[model samples]
Target: MRAYMQGGGFVVEVDPDEIEAFSSRWPCSNLTVTSGKEFLFSAENGDILDAATVSRGRRFSTEADDGSALAALADDACRFGAQALSLTDVLAIRFPDLAQAAPRP
Candidate 1:
């Protein structure tokens, strides 16, 4: 599994099992999985700001693939009261084990 976000221009790939475990443990209400290819993270108003798309192997993409769509969405969401969270903060919250193991500057 992979999580991609343009906010930090990062793509984090982990085992599928780990992703499943995290999903089950946290169960984010704003996350939507569709057809096993797309994962959308929406704002409180249901506007998708971040997204991930699984391709072949451990590779994945994000809403940033469509030019500045991800940025536009993020901006719109923020305008409508969505608080911005950095990719690091998001990863730290969603994958505490991995985040803790990573080197920090």
Candidate 2:
């Protein structure tokens, strides 16, 4: 998985076949994207709260509109395996440039 900024919003690109490694069951969001697809979320404001792609499936995200908040959410996803990893975790290694921008805990 990889994430980057595009047109003021965040775009998450997920590979459809790789989701099984992260979760046994499909995500709750039920959002689907093409294999190696990119989903867009506006930075300014939008109705969508959370969104993710998993093997052509989907999941949730935070409702905050702040760009930094969104970046932090992505960071949390990247660190899914940190301590006690859960099935709901996104299980990404890290974001590209956004990883550097996200504040460390």
Each model's TM-score, in the order given?
0.26, 0.34
Best by TM-score: 2
In the predicted model 2, the residue pairs found to clash are: 16-55, 50-61
Whole-model Cα lDDT per candidate? 0.38, 0.37
Number of backbone collisions per candidate = 0, 2
Candidate achieving the largest lDDT: 1
Candidate 2 lDDT by residue in tens digits, 12-102: 5545444333323424333232333334544343213245433335444323222443344334433422212221212222333333434
Overall local distance difference test of candidate 2: 0.37
Give the TM-score comparing model 1 with the true structure, all chains together. Answer: 0.26
Model 1 collision count: 0
RMSD to native, candidate 1:
11.5
Q: What is the Å distance of residue 92 in model 1 from its true position?
A: 12
